[model samples]
Target: MEMNGSQRIEASREQVYAALNDVEVLRQCIPGCDSIEKTSDTEMNAKVTLRVGPVKASFTGKVTLSDLDPPNGYTISGEGSGGMAGFAKGGARVVLVPDGEATMLNYAVSAEIGGKIAQLGSRLIDGTAKKLAGDFFSKFSQIVGPQPAGDDAPAAEVAEKKGWVGRLRDSL
Candidate 1:
């Protein structure tokens, strides 16, 4: 399946980018995400529980970020196993564009599933993916608040200077 969309995030592009890379932020935003542990600068291990149609499964996965371009965006990819339920692999290209003091966040995602999950039919799988993506973005937008003029700081500064540690702190 493939899906794409854009959202107007009420935060600076830098701030949005920081949030996107923060494991804690992503853990909070992703639907049914139980945990996200950073394993490297560009990779993290994740556990998520998802329900599609009448089936529910817990998946363990590794998520990786590539093609980094600072506050602009990056490519995110991951694959997960659900044992007998199935397995899923997907990737997304995310781009962040500055819009005044806000940011325009766009994403294109491509995914595939096999085993029992694939047998559930495209309509069901597509609907579930869309719902999950929507849920993530809505939660993401809420956490990445618009910085007030007087108390604003670009998160990209932290990412560039102190790496993920500083970015994580700023994200929180």
Candidate 2:
């Protein structure tokens, strides 16, 4: 599966970029993330527990950051195993663009699942992926500060914009 999206973070681009590289922040934001320890400037070990439908599993893995461009963006890739449960491998490229005092964070990611977990079907996986991504971004936006989680009402002028449709869909 693949996901690509963007959000306006209330923090500065530099601050957001630095926070993106911080394993502690990542652990705190990632749902089910149990622990993470940095092994080097670009590598870390992590443990996470995940539940989908009626199945639950604990995963252990190593994450590596590559193609760094400091205070701007980078690519992250990792592979994890969950014993008899399954295995997952994925990669994402995250970019930070300055937006006044805030940061416009964008990302594109791809992932593959295998073993028993893959048998659950794509609809479940797709829905869960959307939820997980929404949850993560919501938490991150909250931490970065005000996210205008305000009224979704759109002006007549905005109703004609393509992005306005997305905003309406997201609000739902």
Candidate 3:
């Protein structure tokens, strides 16, 4: 399956790029992520639990980033196995562009799955993937966005202005 989209992050391009590469930040942003360990400047291992429809499984995977261009994004690819559930491998090319006070993160992704997960059907898998992606970006933006100086009210206002979900829906 192939999925592509972009998110408007409420931060500078450099800030967005840095957060994307930060293992701790990614671990928090990714839904059901158990852990993320950096093995090298451009490589990491991850453990994640995901549910696609009625099937839930744990995945252990390795991700590598290539085509380095600091503060401009890079290519990411990874593969994982979920025991009896299935296996999945995918790659994404990400690009970051400055947008005034914010950054626009664009990504194009393609993936393939096999075993029981594949039997669940493409529609289900596709929807689940999109949902996961949306969740990641939404959480990421909230973490990376500028915090209000002193109030919870302004935080909600910031979230509204960020419009992460609205942007994702528009892209899809």
Report, for all candidates in order, the number of backbone clashes: 0, 0, 0
Alpha-carbon local distance difference test for all models? 0.91, 0.86, 0.93
Best by TM-score: 3
Per-residue lDDT of candidate 1, residues 1-172 (tens digit): 9999999999999999999989889998999999999999999999999999988999999999999999899999999998889999999999999999899999999998998889999999999999998999987997897533542355444465787787688789
Better of 2 and 3 by lDDT: 3
After superposition, which runs of candidate 2 have C-alpha atoms over 4 Å from their true positions? 146-172
Output the number of the lDDT-best candidate: 3
Residue-wise C-alpha lDDT for candidate 2, range 64-130, written one tens digit per residue = 9999998889999999998898999999999999898888999999999998889999889878888
Could you tell me every candidate's TM-score relative to the true structure? 0.84, 0.82, 0.87
Please state the error at residue 45 of candidate 2 in Å: 0.8
Name the better of 2 and 3 by TM-score. 3
What TM-score does model 3 achieve against the real structure? Answer: 0.87
